[model samples]
Target: MPEVTPQQHALFEEQGHVVIGPILPPADVARLRQAFEAQAAAWAAEIDTPLDDYLAVVSQWTNVWEHNPVFREQLYHQRAAAIAAELIGCQRVRVFHDHLIVKPPHGGSTVPWHRDLPNWPVAEPRAVSCWLALDDVTAESGAMRFMPGGHREPVTRSIDFLNEAKVWGERERDAVPVAVPAGSAVFHHCLSWHTSPPNSTAGWRRAYITIYLDATCTYDPTRAAWHPMAGRVSVPAGATFNEDVFPTLGPGLSAAHLATLRGGAA
Candidate 1:
């Protein structure tokens, strides 16, 4: 497993994102890719014909934990979970959700720029997301692009799913395109402004993302839950945190890791 460095922590604090390389070995990456492909194929068969066809051919989908234990296990994978723990400054982090964004060759549309927090049912601002590359991601292959330090800005008015340009302003100068090799990972704040271009390549561009909420983060049950699996673990509105919802990932807890879980640190 790749150890989180102080430099990485500092970069995350300053820029609201960081990239860690070689988090998964080649064999593990292969396993995850196979699992994702299998799940995607199964999902395609369940939804209505054309819609399922579209999803199978040209869109993104998530929340496979309900159907596959392998998908759930991938979310809590020891190395990836450890990285998430470090990113959120928590010893324990809940598997908020898992997402699959597959861009078919020459077909997938661009994902709009948006902050994940606004879309989430939780009120906590410290949640983190790890986007693992399942294939070589490049600018033409629909790699994620993030606006550096955009998370610190005020939350803009939320827009409907159809209006992509209206939802996010033009890309800023500090916006960086993350082109990661398969098996690497990019860690970003939940509030970070990010988007991806359409896939213009010849093969599918696939990625698996697992979102994690710090144990100290509070939940708002009133907000519309994005997934049925989301409500599976719920903490009261004003509660400091819930361990049953956000379990620890490492060998043991410590000041750095436990602080966030107890609502004592960032």
Candidate 2:
């Protein structure tokens, strides 16, 4: 597991995002890619779209861990979660959800600039997403560009991907594209303004993103009533997330605490 050094933590606090160098080795990366390919094939088979067209379509699947064993393990990746916890400055963290975004070579569309917290159902903005790249990412290959310190701004409505309108006025000039090799990851704040351009390269751009919320984070449907994952919530508004769905993780968390997290008797 790679540690988020103090300097790196400072950078994250300052810029609202920071690149964590390679956490997975070549073997792990290979296994993840294989799992994704298999799962993608299954999804393509179930859809009416032709396989060729389906592969070309930019794919965004939420909670793949619910069906894919490899992705299930990835959801609990200690290294990634630890880094997320460190970035959020929380003692413990829980899974909000995981999503897989794949931009196929040549045909993917651009994602408009937006802040994540405004689109989530959480009551607080204490969350971070660990975006692990499954392929070499470059500016020309749908790499994420961020508006540094944009998280400090007030939250706003989600952006329409079909529109090319710029939301962050003068701050757009300060946006920076972050490129990383396969097995590396970049963690960004939930409120950070970010976007990615369409892939123009011959290679695919795949990213598995796991969003971790601070343990104290509570559910709030009003934040995003139509959020895709909102239906999975079993807790009342303003209550802590259910551990069965959002497994809590932390350093030196006791067995009794784990039981409590699961809403069970310790």
Candidate 3:
């Protein structure tokens, strides 16, 4: 599994986000992309909205790991989890959730500018998310833009993506648009300010995001009624997230399996 260098850790703290590889090899990337497309098509077929209305918002299928083996493999990949632990500065990382976000060509809706932690059920800010692109992403293709060092500020209220400017009324022109090729991933702090614009390109913008939380994250009852994770665990408020749902990876990996993952060279 890959580990973060001191320099990368510094970058994350300074900017609130960092760009990582074509983290998966070409074959793995291709397989994951296919899985996401399959899931997206299945979801789009079930939507009854007009194309115009649908394009006004991005599509999100959460906890996709429960449904697809390919997604599950990618979501719990050793390298990816290791990266999350490094960026989050946590001893152990737990699965918060995973989602596939699709932006249809030419008219996908804009994702409103907002901070993630405010909308989640977790009480702490030690969560990180990896947004893996499945298509060639451009600024006009609804690529995510971030406000560098924005996570240092207090959490702000969630925004209505389709109607808002930047979080707290900042200019849209100020956010930094992060464009990367397919297979590249961006890691962002839960409090980082981010949003994506409408897709003006000719192809769909596909993304698979896996979020990891501090292993010791506890449920916040205040947001439980609406937060998705509320129903996924059996623990009470202030209790650690259960192991069955959010497995720890670094110390959890079996010795034999860990060796294989490291190409028998660990």
Candidate 4:
């Protein structure tokens, strides 16, 4: 992850989302691509996922860190975790979840505009996602479109990702297309409003996204329990999430904590 400067921080504060370019080295990007492909090959058939189009939403393995060594390493990668912590202004961050969203070439399903927070169990606004591109993404190739500064707006309900007819009210004009190269990432506040179009190009659009929450984040029982993580989190409502599941990724995390993370990856 590239360093987030004061200016970049300010931009993120204002826009609710910021695109950081070419963060991973070329080699790392290539390695990640291979890892993602391997993960796809290993699990694509095992998982009984149904798709209307050539799209996999929240696809592949949800806890990819526990399944693949490469993804596991990157999930807790210091620079990426550091960037996540800095962006959220938290000393420590916990893994909310990870995703391997694969949009195959031509006729990929459309992802409608919506905020990520309303879809999750976390309550506080200190969570963010690091979306790492595995393939070159363009606007035509289903790159996510974001509404700048959308996080500052009121909490909006999550909508159907396939429905595009719903109006955005007055915020439609501020939407911007985010196109980034492989090895680059788009860091967006969890509440930031975003969506992506169908992949019309010849290449596939794959992204590995890891959501990080403030270490102190706890469950909000009021939210819907659609996500599998909500079931895995052992702590009761309002309790700090269990460390074994959401390991701390930051400076001075105890060896016990690191051991927990290692055991998870192993």
Clash number for each model? 2, 0, 2, 1
**TM-score, cand. 1 vs. native:** 0.83
The residue pairs found clashing in candidate 2 are none
Winner by lDDT between candidate 4 and candidate 3: 4
Instruction: Quote each prediction's TM-score.
Output: 0.83, 0.90, 0.84, 0.86
lDDT of 3 at 25: 77
Name the regions of candidate 4 deviating beyond 4 angstroms.
45-60, 160-166, 252-266
lDDT of 3 by residue, 1-266 (tens): 43655566677888898888878777877898788767655655668655446545647878899888999888778888878876765567898888888877786676777888877778788899999888878888988999888889887766655676663455555678999788888889999988888889889888889989978888776763577777787888888787887766656444454344334222
Please identify which of the two predictions, 1 or 4, would achieve the higher lDDT against the true structure: 4
lDDT of 4 by residue, 1-266 (tens): 22576666777888887778677898988898888776665565466544432134443458888889998888877777877777777668899889878778785677777788888888787898999998999999999999888788887666755554447787687787899889888899988888888889998888999999988998886775877787887888898788887888857344464444434323
- 169 Cα displacement, candidate 2 (Å): 3.9
Worst 10 residues of 3 by lDDT: 257-266
Candidate 2: misplaced stretches above 4 Å?
162-164, 250-266
lDDT assessment of candidate 4: 0.78
Q: Give the lowest summed-lDDT range of ten residues in model 2.
A: 257-266
The full ranking of all candidates by TM-score, starting with the best, is: 2, 4, 3, 1
lDDT of each: 0.73, 0.84, 0.78, 0.78
TM-score of 4: 0.86
Provide the global lDDT of candidate 3 against the true structure: 0.78
